[model samples]
Target: MQNKKRLMRVLGGGALYAATFFFDFDNEILNIAMFLLGYFIIGGDIVWKAVKNILRGQVFDENFLMFIATIGAFAIGDYEEAVGVMLFFQVGELFQSYAVDQSRKSIAGLMDIRPDYANLRRGSEIVKVDPDEVMVGDEIIVKTGEKIPLDAIVIEGESMVDTSSLTGESVPREVTVGSELLSGCVNINGVLTARVTKEFGDSTVSKILDLVENASNKKSNSENFITKFARYYTPGVVILAVLLAVVPPLMYSDQEFTKWLVRALTFLVISCPCALVISIPLSFFGGIGGASKLGVLVKGSNYLEALAQTEIVVFDKTGTLTKGVFNVQEIHSEVMSREELIELTAYAENYSNHPISLSLKRAYGKAIDNAAITNVKELPGHGVQAFVHGKEVLAGNYKLMKKMKIAYFKGEIMGTVVHVAVGGEYVGYIVIADEIKNDAAIAIQDLKTEKVKQTVMLTGDSKSIGEHVAKKLGLDKAYTELLPADKVEKLEELFAKKTEKGKLVFVGDGVNDAPVLARADIGIAMGGVGSDAAIEAADVVIMTDEPSKIATAIRASKKTLSIVKQNIVFALGVKGIVLVLGAMGIANMWTAVFADVGVSVIAILNAMRVLNTQSIHNSTVPAWEGNVEALSNA
Candidate 1:
C-alpha cells in the first residue's frame, strides 16, 4: 500500500513536469505554480528530512545534498532541472529498494524452515502446541508432510524425511527405529512418533536461524572501507562545492557568479556516493544468500573474503575425506587360533566406546562375560591393557607393544592395525579400515580444478592407511599418526609455508578437530546437524557433509568479489570523468543526474547476479564421467 502511494506521487509529479514543455501558459503566475507543484511533490520529503537532520545536527546526508542542490537550481530559475534531479533520484531509490527486496527473499526462503507448531502426545490424545512449549523427553507425533518440530530419536515408526531445507540434498533419507532425526526436516509418507531430545531453544533450526540473522553484523574490509569513505566523502564534497561557488567568482573578474554557482550545484548532484554505498554490500549479501541455497552457510562476509584467497585446503581423515565408521577387514594370529585372538581382543576392548573397539565387538558377535575381565586400564595415545582369563592382554598400536618390551611383527596393510600381546609376548593384530565417501575423490579433483595449490590430509591413523587414502584421492601431501595436539603443531608449520597473501582452509567434523579448525585461516565444519563443537568453532558450515560444497563456496566467493570490484571500478570511473566535465562547464545537471542515479541502478542490477546459484553451481562442477568402476575404485 505504501509503495502504491509513492508510485502514484512519482507518476503524478512526472506528468506535470512533462506538460510544461508541450503547453505554455500565457500567465507567469500559472507557470510558476505548476513548477512549484511538481518540485514539491517529488522532493518534499527530502526537503523535510534535510530540515529535520539540520535541527538534530546530522546534516550531511544524501537528503541534505539533494535538498541544497535542487533548491539552489530553483533559486537560479532552472526550475525544470530542479524537478528532474529529484524525480530521477526517487526512481533510483525505488530500484535500490526492489533489488534489496529480491535479495531478502532468498534469505526469507531459508527462514521458512522454522516450524509453526508441534504435535505433542498427551495421554491417549495428541494436541497441537507451540514448539517452545514442548519440553525435552516429550513424545511428539509427526504426520505425513509435517515439519519435524524438534531434534529427536525415532522410537516407534519408520519413514522418509525430506532434509532439503536443512541440508540442501533433494533425496529423502530413510528413518527407522533408533534413527536420529534433526529439526527442520519434513516427515514424508509415514506416521512417526519420536522422543524429543532437545528443547526448541537448543534445536538445530534455531541455531541456524540465529547464525544467519546475526551474520550481517560482521562486515568485510571492503564494506568497512566504503562505509568510512561515505562518512567523510559527503562533507568534503559539500565544502568543495562551497569553494567552487564563492572563491572562483571572487578571484576572477570575468567569471559570472551565477554560472560558477550552477556548476557547483551540478557537482553536488554528481558526488552523492550512493552507487558505491549501496552496491558493494549488496554484492556480499547476494553471495551469502546464494551460498545458503547450496547448503553452505558462511557466518560472515569476512570469511567469504578469506575463502576467495584460499591457496591450501587441509582435510581431516575421518568423517571428512572418508566415512568415520570403521569395519574389521583382516585378522592375523601368531600362536592362538583366529577365534581365540578375536575373543581376547574383544574382551580387552569391551569397556571402550571407540569406533575401532565397536567394530571388533560387532565382528565377534557374542557377549563377553564381564565377570572374567579384571583390572581394565585404558592408555591414551596407545591402547588398552586388561587381564582376560587370568592372563594379561594388551590391545593397542605398535607404540604400546614397544613400551611393554614385546617384540611384534609389523604388517604391510593399508589400514589401522591393532596389535595384541599375551603375557608380555606378541600374539596377533587386527586391521580396521574405513571406506572413503562416494564424493571424496571427486571433491579433491574439483578443488584442483578450482586452482587450489595444495591439498593435504592430517590423520591419527597409521602411516600406511593415511598414505593409501591420500594417494587414492591424489592429494599433494599426507601426514599420519598425529595426536590432537600434534595436529595443531603441524598446522602451524603449514601456515608458515603459505604465501603472505594466500590463505589456508581447514575442514573437520569431530570434537578433537576443534583446535585445528580454530587455528587455520578459514575453518569449515562438515555435517553441521551432527556436531555442535564443529558448528561453534568453524567459520563456514557445510550442512550436507559433502566435501564438494567447499569448492562451491570458493566459487561463490570469487564471483561475489569479482562483482564488488566491478561495481567499485565502474562507479568511480564514470563519476570521475563526469565530475571533471561538470566543473569545466561541459556537462549540465541532466548529465549529473545520469552519473549518480543511472550508475546506481546499473550497479545494483549487476550485484543481483550473485543470487543466481544454479549458474554458480553448474559452472563450478564439470559434467560427471559415467565410469562407475573408476569412481568405486577411487
Candidate 2:
C-alpha cells in the first residue's frame, strides 16, 4: 500500500475512536491528537502539492481532487471519513507501483543475457579485455566454459558447443579446425583458437543485443491502444470531476455545497488510469519472459501480439523440421556383416571430403582401430578406396558398385547411398539421409491443438523426401523443390489467402530462409547466431534449434493475450460499478479502495502467469543416427 493510504487509515481509525469522546474528555485529547497526526501524514503533502500545481495552472490532478474531498469532510466535522478517503487513494498508488515493477522484472531478465567482457588473445597469450577493444583478424582464445567473445572460426581444437543460449537447440555441435563458431556460445570442452572475422560490437551477439534493446521503440497494436487510452482517459476524468463539483450544486439546492464537492473528489480518486497503463504492459512482459524460459526469444511485444493471431505455421524444411545433416542409416550386406561393411566404408572414407564420407565416419563410430590399412585414395564426388584389415575396400555411390558388377536392392533408401566392396568385390551398401528434428512431430501436433489452421513445409529437397517426412509428422501441406527465392513466393501465395487478422508464421534457420522470414507475419529464426540475415529478418528467435520452442512461444502468446483480456474486463467492470455509485452519491471509501488496490492485485496475479507456456514436449532422434550428445553439463 502507498504510505499515504496507511497514514490515512490510522488517522481514520483514531478519529472513529475519538467519536466516543464527544460525551467524555477524560482521554479524548489523546485520541484527537493521534487523529490529527494521521491526517497530516497522509493528506498534508497531497494538499500542498495540489495548491502548488493549481497556482502553476495545472489543476486536474488526483492530488488536487483528494485535497478538496478531505477538506470538505473536515468542514462537516467527518474527521474519520476524510482520513479513510486519503488512505484508500494512497493504497491504489502502491498497488500500481508493485504491478509495474513485476512486469519490468520479466523483460529485465532478458536484458541480463548481454555480457560485459570478452577473452582476448595477444601474441600467443590469452587476456581478458572489454568487448569493444576487440579487432578484426585478431586471434582470440575462447577456452572451455567461456562465452565466445566475437564471431570467428576455430583455428585449432575440437569441442561440443552448447548453442541453446542462442539457437534454442539443446544439442551440442562439434567444432573443429575451420568450423565457424559465433559469439555468446559457451565452449563446453577443448581449447578453441579462433581468428575473429568481425569486431566486438559488429559481431552477431552484438547485433542481437542492439535489436532487442530497441525493440520497444517499435510499438505493437496493444501498446498503442493503451497509450492513446491513457492520454485521453486522464484528461476526461479530470473534466468529469470539474462538472461534478460545479454542476451538482447549481442543478440541485438545499443540499450542502461541500457535500456535493466531496462526492466529486471521491470520484476523481477512483478514476486513476494507472491500472490500465501498468497492467497492459505487464501482460506482454510476462509473456515474453515466459517464452524465453521455454527457449523462445521474442524480440518485442509486437511479435508477441502477432503470434496470438497466428493461424498458419509454415516451416522451412532443412534445419527447421528435419535435422540438417545427412547421416548413414541402414546397411544391406550380401556376405560381410553390417559391422564389417561399415568398417570398410569408414576406413576408405577417411580419405574423402565428400558428405558421404562424413556420414560413413559417423556411422562407423569414427574410431577405426583396424591396423592393416594402406593404399588410401579418394575420388571427389564419386567414392573412396583403401586396403582395410588386409582386404581391399571400395565405398562409393552406385557407380562404383556398377563398375564392379553389384546387385541393387531397394528398401527405404531415404538418404544417400554408399556401396561397399571387399577386395574390389561388391559385398554391401549403406544409405544416408538428413533426419528430422526430434520435436517436429510434437511441434506440429501442438500447433493443431492450439487452433493453428494449417501446418506446411517448404523445402528445396525432392518431393519424395519432403513427402516422406511430412507423412510421418502429419503436416497439412508440403511444397518441395523451392529455392530460397521460391520460398518467398510461396509465402506470398499463402499470405494472399489469409486476412491480416490471421497470420502466417515462418520458421527458418540462418541466411538460407531470410526472405520467407521477412515475408511472414511473424518470422521465427532457428539457430540464430552469426546468421545476420536470420537475425535481421526474424522477429522471434529460438536461440536453440529446438522445434518445440515454436510451440512454447505460441502457448505463451495465447496465455498472455488471455491475461490481458482478463485484466481489461476486471478493471473496467469494477470501475464501471463504482463510477455509477460515486455519481449517485451512494458510493463511499470502500468502493474507491476496491477500484484501486483490488483491481491492481487481480491484474498483477494474472500477469505473472507469463513465466510458463503450460505445455512441454518430448525430445526426438532420427531413425538411423545414434547417441547424439544433446548438451554438455553446462
Top model number, TM-score: 1
Q: Once superposed on the true structure, which residue ranges of model 1 sit more than 4 Å away at CA?
A: 19-23, 331-352, 361-410, 418-430, 618-634
Task: Please provide, for model 2 over 1-634, each residue's C-alpha lDDT reduced to its tens digit, 9 standing for 90 to 100.
Answer: 4545554554664465455446454665665665566677656667789899999987755576577667766666776777766766665555555656656765565444455677777877778888788888888787778888788988888998877666545779999999998877778988898888988777877886786667666666877898898777867987897798788678878666777776676677677655666777778877776666566778888898888888889998878877678776677887978887787778877766677677788878856664667888776556777888778887787776666676655555665677777765668778777767766777787788778899999999878778877777789999998899888888888987777699999998857887778778888988545667666778988766767677778777877888888888888888878877887789875676567666777777777766654543232323323223111100
lDDT of 1 by residue, 1-634 (tens): 5556657778888999899989999998899889989988877877899999999999888788889989999899998889988998887777677777777887678656899999999999999999999999999999999999999999999999999898888999999999998999999999999999999988998888888887788898899999999999889989988998999889998999999999998898888898999999889988887888888989899898788899999999888987777777778886989999999999999999988899999989998999989999999989999999899999999899999989887746666789999998888998887777767777888888879999999999878778878888889999999998999999999988899989999999947899999899999998567667766789999988888889999999999999999999999999999889888888898899889889988998999899888766724444334212221233
List TM-scores for all candidates, in order: 0.88, 0.76
Q: With candidate 2 superimposed using the best TM-score fit, by how many Å does residue 377's alpha carbon deviate from the native?
A: 13
Q: Return the TM-score for candidate 1, rounded to 2 decimals.
A: 0.88
| Backbone clashes counted, model 1 | 0
Q: RMSD, each candidate, Å?
A: 4.0, 6.7
Which residue pairs in model 1 clash with each other? none
- Which window of 10 residues has the lowest lDDT sum in candidate 1? 624-633
Candidate 1, residue 119: how far the Cα is off, in Å: 1.7
| Model 2 CA deviation exceeding 4 Å by range | 1-84, 118-128, 136-198, 202-208, 331-357, 360-412, 418-429, 496-500, 528-532, 612-634
